[model samples]
Target: MKNYKFIYVLIGLTFFLSSCEEWLQVEPRQSIDSATALSSQEAITAATNGVYARFRSVALYGRDFLAIPELLADNAFNTGAGNRLVGQFNNQPGSHMGNWGTAYFTINQINLILRALQEVELPVEFRNRIRGEVLFLRALLYHDLARVYAYDPTADIPGVNVGGVPIVTQGTLTVAEVEYPARNTVDEVYTFIYNDLEESLGLMQNFNMNRRPFFVTRGAVAALFSRVALYRGDYARAIEMSEIAMASGVANFPADPVSGWRTQVQPESFFEIVFTTQDNIGANESLRATFMSRVFLNDAVAASHGNVVFTDELAAAFPDEDLRRDLIQRGLAVNSGVFEINKFASKNGVPNLDNVPVIRYSEAITNKAEAHYHLGQFDLALTELNKLRVRAGLEALEGITGPQILDEILLEKRREFAFEGHRFFDLKRLGRDIIKPTGNVEHSDFRILANIPNREIETNPSLVQNRGY
Candidate 1:
């Protein structure tokens, strides 16, 4: 294991130095005093916008979380064929420093904003809206961190108060806060997330949600709450919150692939991290760079530097008539037939300008369906699954009963949200092995969770590495 100091000093220096390839469009911002920056309404707004810019950084949604989960599971394959790191995550998962460090660093930025906002003199409506948005984003970040780093609170692990990353909410104002923070329990983290989302909802309710899909809204809070509840096994709450979200009229499953998965945000996306021509994270490291064929990303060639694409096993999982098949590119002559993940290809005819979807409406229906199935309401579960299927013009699921309904629901989710970061979490939450569609994983192996970055443990003696790492 490597023992390196946190170069956060350098990180702080480069925090505002945006290159042309970066996806977020924000003005250059250097570090400023929390009190001084927060004193003005304009400064508070910029600080809040800075949170989104940091969230979209390369280590966060820019690549690791959005694309790597698909690589970790079976939704997408590293075209490098074990030559590089995605293969390592699939074959034998280990320390994911990019995801771990970036998550906390992003969290620190949010905390700074929160602390600053407390003393700022802003209009009540504007203040509520900004604070609510930050809270929603904070909840979302913690939820993902818990998913990757810590064991589930409901897992059969034998420890009380033992399943979380460190709970660092407020900015580092004291030595005790920064140097000696202990990990919170998974239950505590979930509690924190739930409370944050609830507060976000209450605050956001005061404002009209006329913002773009890139920004958080009341619907996003409800949607995230539904997901958190589902993860925590609160089936009734999941159903309730999901229904509330579905009623918000922001998300839907458009039957076609071009709009359903291709267009970043239509009626279907509750929240998306947007990229524009002025802010595209250039060709090499973009989602389009990794997923689509080179020709699709920039018309470079038929196959230049083909990185990540759909495995044939994944392709066969979808039925012939499903529009989701369009999410996977086909009909190319290379390799007997070329197949690529075409979901994130350039939409506005500009390379790498695709918006990353964070929350969508179809998830609420499926989440509610799973909750219903878990609560033994099999008919209701099947009804919800049919809602999604019928939207895509697929035949309704009938004759499904008992545990098969759960299996069908999961399969439907795999079809719907593959390459969008749900496969690994779903499998882990359901207590299934990480067997891929291609039958490549080690059987009965429990290496589902990512290892805590070695540097973190070395720096903080209190931090515990995951078992069997």
Candidate 2:
């Protein structure tokens, strides 16, 4: 807690500024004096925009969240082109999602904004909207932290189930204000997330704002709730929230799968991180560069490493005539024999620039499908599953029962979200072993949970490292 002075120091500075356009266009980072304060709506709005900017970080959605999960699971492989993601591809110990510090940093910012919201005077509508936004963001960060740092409630090992990440709601600004908190129970963390979502929804009801897809909305909150409930194995709640989210109609299945990926805003996105031309992370760090050789879908030359390629198992999952198969193309001549994913290939029509979808309608449908399967509603499950299967040019199942329905749901989820970062967590939450080309990593493997930061353990005596770290 004491070691991360940089995040603490950012408490008062307007570190990032963005204009309120139709899209949230985050400006370049610049540090102002620490005396800057969130005393007014304008200041708080700027601070909130800064928090959203953190999602674009390489540590979060910009790259690692999308790439590392594929590498850690069986869906992707490292081509050894740029010497990147090879360790993750091999399932090496300690080579996992390392966003603990970055997440906490953003969480603290949200905490501060939440605190200030009560004090700073504003119209009830504006204040409620902002509060709803920050609360949703906070829940999202904690959920990500818990999923990575601890076992899911449904899959916790008997003797080896450590606790989830620390639950920090209060803001920390100074050394005297910092608290060395211990891990909370996994159930406690999920309960906290549920509470936050409930309150956020309460605050946002009938409060209409047009920040769809890019900014958090009531629909986005419901969509995320569906995911959280599904991960927690709360089947009934998952179905309820998925229906609420679907009803809001923030996003939906696109008319054309291939054309949808080329659009600036994802038709399926409930919440997406918008990356403007000025914010392009370039060939070195962008998802487009890491996954595909060509900057544009039609380009013939190589642009970046094209380091992460599809695994044979994943490639074989798609049928030859599937529309989704068109999302992959042959790599540059240098890496000729391989095929690369083009899902993130310049959707913005600019090299290395694409919006990252954090939550979407497809997830909600699959979540409902899986939840229904678990609750013994096979017909209802197949109804939701077939939507995606038919959309992807695969034949729908006529008759399936028991575990077979679950198998198809999981398989469809894997195929639909192959490279978009759900592979590893999906298997983990269900207590299933990760089938990798390197070897099968059992559910009980200690590496299933990432190691807490060494510095965090050393500084915060109350902090407990995961077993086998």
How accurate locally, in lDDT, is each candidate? 0.72, 0.84
Worst 10 contiguous positions by lDDT, candidate 2 = 17-26
Per-residue lDDT for 250 in model 2?
78
Q: What TM-scores do the predictions have?
A: 0.89, 0.94
Model 1 ranges off by over 4 Å = 1-35, 81-84, 95-97, 154-156, 159-162, 173-177, 255-257, 262-264, 297-300, 331-338, 437-446
Task: Supply every candidate's count of residue pairs whose N, Cα or C atoms clash at under 3 angstroms.
Answer: 1, 0
Best lDDT goes to which candidate? 2
Model 1 per-residue lDDT tens digits across residues 82-201:
243454445565634257777776677678678767776668888788889999999989998898877664453554224688888776543344554678878889999998998999
List per-candidate RMSD values in Å. Answer: 3.6, 3.0
Tens digits of per-residue lDDT for model 2, 1-469: 5656446444432232222331122244233234545676666776787788888889899999999999988899898878887888988889899999889878888888888888888888889988998898989999999888899988889799878889999886665776788999999999999999999978867643466678888889999999999989999999999998888877877765677787788888988998888678888879998998888888887776999988888888888878889987789967677878888988787889999999978899999999998899999999999999888887888887999898888888888887899999998998999987698899999988899989888778888899888
User: Where does model 2 exceed 4 Å of error?
Assistant: 1-36, 207-209
